[model samples]
Every structure is written in structure tokens, then in C-alpha cells.
Target: MPKIVDREERRREVVEAVFRVVARGGIQQATLQNVAAEAGLAVGSVRHYFESHPELLTAAAREMVHRVEARVRAQRERLGPDDDPHDVAEEIAGQFLPLDAARADETAVWLEFAVAARTDPALGPIAVELHDGLRTVAGRLLHRLGVDDPVATEHLAAVLDGLALNAALHPDRLRPDAVRAVLRRHLAQLPGGR
Candidate 1:
């Protein structure tokens, strides 16, 4: 029998190729040819999965968001019942930072997509969705800490974004240890922090 192809898995592979291209270079370099080469497939194969560049970009962005959310949820589930609320908040917020190699790659790709979304109409909505999702996470953390301020949630979201951007771009300067320390300190200073 002829080999069967997993279309959904193949599409995920193509999306991962796009992420590799963007993470290695930038969004500008994530062309169909480069992505195909990265995935060890022909350009025609890539086209078979995604008809156009915009569709591929959108898929890659969505995949990155999905990965980030999965990681965050997993981390949240690992928390102990007796863990301090502030510590829990810190751990949850740390999920957004580039503390490890996989997270660093995801952060790099996410930042590229967010920047490109500024002018790309197709990517703008994805970017907004990502922003809102992060803010909602921040709000939950704030509520857990007994704070109920929308502005505080927004500020925390911005802080997390800045920290992730800095850690992703300058890992040498802002090491994971430093990022954790900064995040712990920030969480400690929150209104209801212990």
C-alpha cells in the first residue's frame, strides 16, 4: 500500500517551519521557499498546505499562541494547593517570559508577528486577540491576588510584554534568573501581595 499522509500533521509541520524561519531571521524572511526548505519539503508541497503567504503567516501566529497558552495552563496545573497566591501569580506570569529555549523561540516568533501586524491587515486581528488573551490572564492573576483594577491588569500585561521582549532579544543581558527575580519582585509589589 502507498504511504498515507497526515494532512493535519503536515500542516503543523509547515507552520513550525514558518516559526523556524521567523525565529532564525525575521518575519520578512519567512518566505514560501525558505519555509519549504526548512520543513524539508518542496515549495509546491507547502503551497498544497497553504495557498498563500498570508494564510501561512496567520496559521503560524495562531500556532504560537496555542503553544504559549498550553504551556501556561500546564504550569498553572502544577501549582500546589498551599502555594502562596503571590508566588502562584509570579509563576503564571513567568510563563510569558522566555525562560527556556522553547519559550524563547515562541517569544521571538510572537514578537515578530506582533510587529508585522501593525501594517499587515491580515495579521492585525490575530495580534489583537493575542493582546487581549494576555490581558485576560493578567486580570485573573490580579484577581487571585485580591486586586480588582482594570488599569492594573493592563499595566501588568504591558510589563510582561516588555519583560518577554527584553529576555527574547537580549538573553545575554537578561538571563532567566534575572527575569525570574524581576518578576518575583514585581509581583511582590502588587497591591495585595504578601
Candidate 2:
């Protein structure tokens, strides 16, 4: 009897391959053929999963958002019962920053795909969805931190996104301490700061 392949698992494998190729060689180099090779599957097999390159790229980009959400959710669960929710919120936000190897790879892959989204109509919606998801997460965190002003929370989230992207591009210019300091300063300016 032939072995059965888990379709969902194979799809995840292809998405991960897409991430790896994009991280290593940018979006232009992450062709369907390249992804199929990276995933150790036949080109036809990959095509069986995604009819077109745009379909695969969009799926991979959305999967990236799902990956980040899962990571943050897991970290939140790891927090002790007595742990301050505000601190956890900060940590969750920090996870989006490319401070370490794993996150750096994720950031690199995301940046490449985001640039591609500018010209790829099929991928644009997925990129927008990921952006909105990140914005929502940031807003929720700020609100949980006692930030009552929606405008202020939105601005802060935008600032945080800018800081992370800039820092990821120039690690030496924006150290983790500097990033943490900025976050702390912003929190201090909140309604009830310590």
C-alpha cells in the first residue's frame, strides 16, 4: 500500500520552503521551481498544492502572519499567572522585532514578500491582511496596557513598526537596549505610569 500524505502538513512544508528561499535569495529568486527544490518535492507536487506562483506566495505570506500569532500566543501562555499583563504585552510586541536569529530570518522573508506585494496583485491582499493583523495585535496590547486613546495607540503601533523595521535593517544603529528604552519611555507616558 502507498503511504498517505497529510495535505495540510505538506502545505506547511511548502510555505516554509517559500520562506527559506525568500530569506536566502529574495522574492525574485523564490520561484516555484526553487521552492519545490527547497522543499524536496517535485515541481508537479508543488503545483498540485498551488496552481500558480502568486497563489503560493500569497499563501506563504499569510502563513507568516499565522506563524507570528502562534508564537506570541505561545509566549503569552508561558507567562506565570501572577505575571503582569502589561509586561507580557511588551514582550509580545518585542517578538515582532528582529532581535535574534529566528526573528531576523522571519523579518527578512517578510520584507522580501512585502516588496513583491507592491507589484503582485494576488499577494497584495495577503500583505494587507498581515499588516492589519499586526496593527490589531498592537492596538489590543496598548489598550490592555491602559492606553485609552485610540489615536495614540495607533500612532504608537506605527512607531513600533517603524522602529522594528529600521532596527532590523541597521542592527548597530538601533540596539535592543535602545528599542527597549523607547518602549519603556512610551509606557511611562501612559495614563498611570510607574
Candidate 3:
């Protein structure tokens, strides 16, 4: 008899290990051996699922995108028809913020991948996809709130990006409550936001 494995679950564990590795160090540290050690599995076992280092990073980055997308979808679904614009903004944008430990870790991994993708050709396209996806989400969220100006969408998207970046870099300066307040404040700056 042999040990049966749940491939998807194991794969997810490997992805999470990659996240931990990237968060602790940077993308350069998320090699097959390190990730396997983080995941508490053998290197061969990780390779069984990912084949190569680039493939592992690619898969992990894709998983991060899917997780963020799923979170945004859930946030949208959870909103009631009568929720206020500020409330909606906070809820949706909150998905991308480094609010707590879990969100901070996720944000760290995202930042690492994004910076690495700037130089790594293998990650460039997915990085663009992640960037465009968030921008599109911001635009759609603004559109739903009756804001048609593309500038408004850029405003919202840039605010989110800045907040996430600062929160990751300066957690003491831009704490969780401050992150929410900054977003709401940005929304209030827009026309008809009040």
C-alpha cells in the first residue's frame, strides 16, 4: 500500500509555503528546496507538482491572483443593495490592504512578486495581469457607484496601491485604521462621494 495524496490540497500547501518563503526573504529565496522545507515536504515532492522553479513561482503567483479575485468577488456578493459608497469602498478595497497578520503576509508576498516580476520575464506577464486586474476592479467599483470619470478610477486605484505599499513598508505610520480612513478620505474627495 502507498500513501494517497490530495493533489490540489498539497499543491495549495506548496503555494502557501512559497508565500511564506517570499514573505520572509524575497522571491529569490523561494526556490524548490526552500519551499519544500517551508512546506515540510521533500524537494522531489514539490517538483512532482511544479516540475521546475519558474513553474512553481508562476503557479504560486497565479494562485495569489485567484485568491485575490475570489476575495473581491466575495466582497461584492456580500454587499447589500443599500450599502453606502464609503462602506462599499472600504469593504472591497479592504481585501487588498495589509490590515492584520494574514493580510500583511499576503501583501508582503504580493509586493515581492511584483518587484521580482519587473526583471523576471517569466513573471512579467502575470504581474501585468495582476496590475491590470486590480485597476479594472477599481474602475468597475467606481462605475457602480456612478463615477464615470477615468481619473476617478485612477484616483481610487492609486490610493489603494499607495496604501498597500506604505502599510507594508511603514506599518507603524499607516496602521490598519489609518488605511481605512485614508481610503474613505480619498472617496470623499471625489464628486458626489459624500
Candidate 4:
């Protein structure tokens, strides 16, 4: 008899292995063999889902995006559009911060992969695409908030990224409310945000 496989589920498992490898040893060490061991599968098993290491890294980046988008969507759904602006902003940005164990793990993995992206030619494009996609999402959110300023959406996205990075490094420096306050201040600085 032959074994059966759920292709999608197996792929997700492999992507998760990539995350674990990154979190434990950084992306530089997340070779196919490491990922296979992290996933508790044979190298061929992992390769069955991803044709190569580059493919695995790219998939991991995409998986990170999916994780973020899923969290944001769920948070937005729970808060609804009527939530306070500060609360809404906090919730959205919180998705990126390592405020909890799960998020901390994700942050570690993401940072490792990001560092690898800088020098790994194969992963560079994946990182760029992820960065651009997130920026677009943030820009659209700013546009929806009526922040069509001189610099436009790009500025808004940049601000979000800056805040997220800062919050991740020094949570004590910015607190959730502080993050919201900064965002509110930015909005108030806009032409008619007040």
C-alpha cells in the first residue's frame, strides 16, 4: 500500500519548520537539512513540498505575511470599524510587536529571516516583495483614514514600520498607548485630522 499525503498541510508543516529553524539558529543555519530535522521529517519529505532551499525561504516569507494578515483581519473583525482610533491603531500595530510568546517567536523568526535576506541572493526578492506588500497595506489604511498628505501613503507606511521596529526593540519606551498617541499626533498634524 502507498501512503497518502495532504499536500497543503504538509507544505504548511514545512513552512513552520522553516520558522522554527530560523528562531532557533537564524536563517544562516536554516538549511534544508536543519529544516527537515526541525520539521521531524526526511529531507526528501520536506523537498517534496519545496523544490529547493530558495523555495522554502520564499515560502516562509509568504507564510509570515499570511500570519500577519490573518491576525490583522481577525483583530479588525473583532474591533469592527467603530472602535476608537487609538484602539484600532494599537491592535493593528500590536500584531507586529512581540507582546506575547507567540508574537515573540514570530518576531525572532522574522528578524532572522530578514537578516538572511540581506545577504542571501535567493531570499532577497522574497523580502522585497513582502516589504512592498506590507507597505501597500499600510498605505491603503492611511488613505482610508484620510491621510492623503504630501508624502502620501509611503510616509504612512514608513511611520508604521518605524514604530513597529521601535516597539519590538524597546517595548518599555513606547507602550501600547504611547504607540496610539504617536499615531494620533501624526493624524492631528495632518491638515484636518483634528
For residue 14, model 1's alpha carbon misses the true position, in angstroms, by 0.9
lDDT of each: 0.92, 0.82, 0.89, 0.74
- TM-score between model 3 and native: 0.96
TM-score of every candidate relative to the true structure: 0.96, 0.87, 0.96, 0.78
Candidate 4 residues 98-167, lDDT tens each?
6676776677777776778888887787678767876666665656566655475666666666776676
Per-residue CA lDDT of candidate 3, range 155-177, in tens? 78888989999999999999999
- What global local distance difference test value does model 4 have? 0.74
lDDT of 2 by residue, 60-128 (tens): 888888888899889878876587756767688877877677787788877887788888888888788
Of the candidates numbered 1 and 4, which has the greater TM-score value?
1
Q: What total of clashing residue pairs does each candidate reach? A: 0, 0, 0, 0
Candidate 2 local lDDT, residue 55: 86
Clashing residue pairs for model 2: none
Candidate 2 Cα outliers beyond 4 Å, as residue runs = 80-82
| Global local distance difference test of model 3 | 0.89
Which ranges of candidate 4 are over 4 A from the true structure? 150-156, 166-194
User: Model 2 lDDT vs. the true structure?
Assistant: 0.82
